[model samples]
Target: MKKTILILLLHSSLSWAQMQPFPLQEVKLTAGVFKNAQEVDLKYMLALNPDKLLAPYLIDSDLPLKAERYGNWESSGLDGHIGGHYLSALAMMYASTGNPEMKSRLEYMVSELARCQAKNGNGYVGGIPNGKVFWERIHKGDIDGSTFGLNNTWVPLYNIHKLFAGLRDAYQIAGNQEAKNILIGLGDWFLELIKPLSNEQVQQVLRTEHGGMNEVFADLYIITNESKYLAAAQRLSHQSILKPLLAKEDKLTGLHANTQIPKVIGFEKIAKLTNNADWSGAAQYFWQNVTQTRSVAFGGNSFREHFNPIDDFNKMLVSNQGPETCNSFNMLRLSMALFLDKNDVSYLDFYERTLYNHILSSQHPEKGGFVYFTPIRPNHYRVYSQPETSMWCCVGSGLENHTKYGELIYSHTHNDVFVNLFIPSELNWQEKGIQIIQNTNFPYINTTELVMKLPKNQSFSLNIRYPKWAESAKVTVNGKIQKINKKPSEYISLDRKWRNGDKISIEFGMKTRLEYLPDGSNWAAFVRGPIVLAAKTSTEDLRGLFADDSRMGHETKGKLFPINKAYALVDESGNYLSKLKPIDNLNFTLDSLHLQPFFDLHDARYQMYFQTFTKEEYEKQKDIQKQTEEALMALEARTVDKINCGEQQPEVDHNYIGEQSNSGYDEEQFWRNTRSFISYQLLNKDQRGTYIEISSLDDFKTENLEITINGISIEVFSNNSKTIRLKLPKAEQISLKIRVMSNYTTPRFTEIRIISNE
Candidate 1:
């Protein structure tokens, strides 16, 4: 191809088709669609459960990657099987950048996957719960025992759902042709497998953790305009969460909120694409139920990945692990959809809230792994999994979290550009042949400038985001001011043009505010500009869960503690808010404020939110805490890092806080040590959007439940079950409920999973 012809083809085929405006005014890390995505999928993982049926297939099969053997070694790859996340991450990266290598690698993987299916002569693709026996059990109606267990994810058909979605995303978002075929075959296989099963039986399997198979399938159906995928999507829907959403009820507490959000999003997609207004209404209703009724101050909810009990989230503050990165991922997706379709500023409002605080804050300042949740209580630490080690759902989101730092910065109407986020990056809208660079160090510095380069005499409208946090927003061009209203929660547009180089800087003078979490506990968080401030304490001084090794370990080094005690408090007026600043010279810190980024404070413990404990309550718990501390120190002694500094590693997971490290240590360590919980402290702020975190439905699998409607043996599982299902006939007027059985006297459920055909 000649140079002129090649250049023409490149411009036509590549950047012209998709032009995304990055939020930050910086050159973000974006690889072309095919190049960066393939490397991420094929390079980043090291799976421990090689035969788990859902392991990342990128690593060598014999790579010392078994959960049973060498499970505790970081090299063991225990946390590597997250299909939904990885696929999505890969898809997003691929779509954002159209790299041919990425396209080729994705195609190769899909082709290999097709070959794997052909070899198995079954539609299945994964190594986990790795045998075909689970299918056999279901075939014979042997519900007591599963071919494979479900929590973390079930049949991992849920895991495969991720791959299916990834392939679909690659095709739709990035325009990959081969991805379409691979995903279609996978969906057909899923449809065929469930063909012989009744709703009850299928629901029984659904009882196990299945990542958003329905969401991706529904999305695929839309792309392909095929209803079988949609039907299969509906079949996989968990009625537990949807029934309430359909009824406009608020029963989201204690449920795996993120898992259900995507499903709700799938319904939203279906409702929109198929033009089912009822489904559309249900999705909107659910979004309202979860967002308005069940959200926390952080613009997130679902502690420990489930909905907590109604209005009683305080009981689980010490366990403040709600709003998984995955949940936020789903919420953002749903919010974006709502924004695009409805063009509602309200949706964008929530998007802005989470993007800056939760999502942007989720990434580790150093290692780049994303936190699973943005905790709301002090002392619970946040950590990230190792790149080669931790591959949890958060890891997948982590992959996506950083790659799209430029996303949503600029959205457009037919004529004007809408700027949303305040990241320091540039936007090249090639269609208009205009290059607009946003210049500013956001969250650190409160100002941003959008410098535009356009053809001489060309004119257009530029709408800048006058954030809700802005006290005064000004739009000025070339020393001559432009008239624009600084309306709260809406964009301020300036329509005028002409020139080689022009500048319009919207100085949204940031203000500081005290934010309150809604659990009724009194304490407030400091927010100056877009950054949330957290109190820091040292981890070297604390052991076990409070140490640097634990997932819930504190982020601070012994606090500037000895010295911080003096600077930690303020008087009647909020004078300390601006007075307390981050020291200007800390090379490692992002910004210096009285409070630090939730992900950075690895030295001393930090608190985003707090409560004043009664002196008596503190005294009474002294002995109990002592015992806990002793056990914790002992546990920490066992997890030392053998290589670096010859020091003990942090005990990061709450599941292993005071307990001995599990064999899944290395993978566990990636999540535990790298991750920490951040609490937002507010004393009696308004009680809106208080979120509830739920436990897993996997816990329900262990119970002996007899669920029957109309005398049909609706019994779905064995004794000591990992998951059980209760299928419902679709209707808006049926009054149906299940007698959930468990060996324990009472198992606390924080969330209610729902599936609906109504």
Candidate 2:
């Protein structure tokens, strides 16, 4: 058994790496269309002060720190997370651009982190608040783990995992030998921290959001070729999420979207390394479920960071918090993993769609700000994060997102080089002494020309991706038309002995199409090939266009325009795309509305999806929408603060605390109730609020429910039998607690709101 395991580990690293696409360092993005965005992202990366980001590390190391910690989440408990992400971003940017500044930044961060680890006098290194004590508690089996917080610490595992990933990237991508040493030490520390805990206890700790600790462990195993790291990776796997996935079950609905994506990426990595078909199949199933059923046209899913029902997207259409940038960031990682595993063009198709629509569109093109959410709520705008102000998860992912655009453009396996995306870039295959330069206007011109420069005559196969969106294509080798035979979403292979200055160009025209919501709703988004087209609405009242250093800075506090006010595409035959008029440079015109690429529409109110109806159907729906919008707007006007019960992040953000409580969703409604007691701190920004409204699907006649505000009981009487409103004795900020004192289970609490009297 020992010999077999040893041989497997020795061979696993080689086989596992072959299964991966070419490293970002090997493929260099040239000066082209993507260069500007890359430069802007570089500016954003360099603009952030590393000293402030490294403060928590300095404090942890007992070293003197000069800069105050950045505000928002950076000052909050999730400290040093940005520093971790900065390491990865700097490493990747340095590799991609060969920039001295980026290399210096990466080196500085690694040195500071090493100093911190050395000062600790243990292998452990993290910026979690009193992180040593926190790990000590978990080491002693004194764990109180929740989905968001563990041992009363705010996602300490998740926070630490960022550093783990950063160090790995630093060693693997940036070729820093010292980083490898530091990373191994930290990995050893983690192993010892959990050495005393039983498997059951380790699983208990895994219940919290750990941000792909297993993935990093698997990566560590690959790096060191050691069995202990692989065993630790297995021990760290979250069974609750993994078991159902292994059985090919879709148990992802109503869960935090970003939390699960990284875990699945890890699962796929482990699967490839161990040749575990079940694990591989589980990751494949998850990818299909998310991309096909859950994700919107922009290739993003979830509402306010939590997945809603797959069969229903009504919440997505109404909520200002739409798809999170972090989710797409992780999804792209998973997509790239799957693509490498099977060489599947389908994964690349989704990857291209998401890369252009969500990831590229996430950043502020000129000002270099990162966006957390890309709201699909008709005319709702998005908030951009400044370097010092916003330390949100999206900000961390956003930093790394733009730095690695050269990653998937071209992937090679031995002698075969695969052209995946249409992005203008260059690749240097030093092993083969070959340099490939691909240039194109892309979606504007629909043609990309690849010029290969080889040191000598080289025998290699060039595989060009025939994307799912291309209707027909023409291939030319050195200006001579070649016999082309390939289907949509398949790669066209050209195997030959290639010499220097060989030019191959592909011309494939894009067609306009309309994609409906996953739930089969009437609302639809337009697509030109992989690019999503959006209509520019009024830019009025775009509050927080740039985010401030506030707790909820990432959220766009702008007014939401009613969905009914959005222009509808009135086409009974569903041939709306056929009637569209093409403007210049990937722009189109439909029904007096000029539509452009969603990625190009920035800092303005835009509509990604439009409700489609025939002339006759529109007349019938118009009156109903108007009536519904009026009521909703009136209620929103009075709402001071609101809580969507059963949702994880919102409840946590609202400072939710409970005993003997559980949460679930049913019939498109999420509810939270407790046999003992549950409470949320509701904010009354002003003392003008006169009442508290609690909406539940409870029958008050059958169940005895007691509700209180700050230890004072409030009388609840049903006025219309649908909702019960408690007239507040005084309007002030208070914790509202609901207790089921009787034997019956408390009714499902759907919503709790503080409303100001008109």
**What is the RMSD of candidate 1?**
14.2
C-alpha lDDT of residue 61 in model 1? 30
| Residues 1-758 of candidate 1: C-alpha lDDT, one tens digit per residue | 00111112112221221223332222343223212333443344322132332233423232332233212221222222454344555555555554454455555555555555565655555434433565555555655312123321233554555667667766765566766776777677667767888898877676545667677777766666676777777777777666777777776554445657777787776555555667667788877776765666566676655565545565335443546677777788888776655555567767877766677566544444446655664554555555434445566666666545455767654345667766555566655566766776665556667777766556666767666767777777877777765586776767776576777666667666666555454455666555566666445444322223223332222211211121223344434344444453111222343456443354345666643334464455456656765664453333211111001121112111111111111211111110111111111112221211212223454234334333343544233332233443332222222333433222222222222221
Candidate 1, residue 447: how far the Cα is off, in Å: 2.1
lDDT of 2 by residue, 71-177 (tens): 77876688989989999999999989889999998888899889999999888888888888888889999876556667556788899999999999999999988
Which ten-residue region of model 2 has the weakest summed lDDT?
1-10
Q: List where candidate 1 sits over 4 angstroms from the true fold.
A: 1-80, 94-108, 139-155, 292-294, 320-323, 456-459, 541-593, 599-604, 612-758
Regions of model 2 farther than 4 Å from truth: 1-10, 13-20, 674-679, 697-724, 727-732, 737-748
Highest TM-score scorer:
2
For candidate 1, report its TM-score.
0.68
Predicted structure 2: lDDT: 0.85
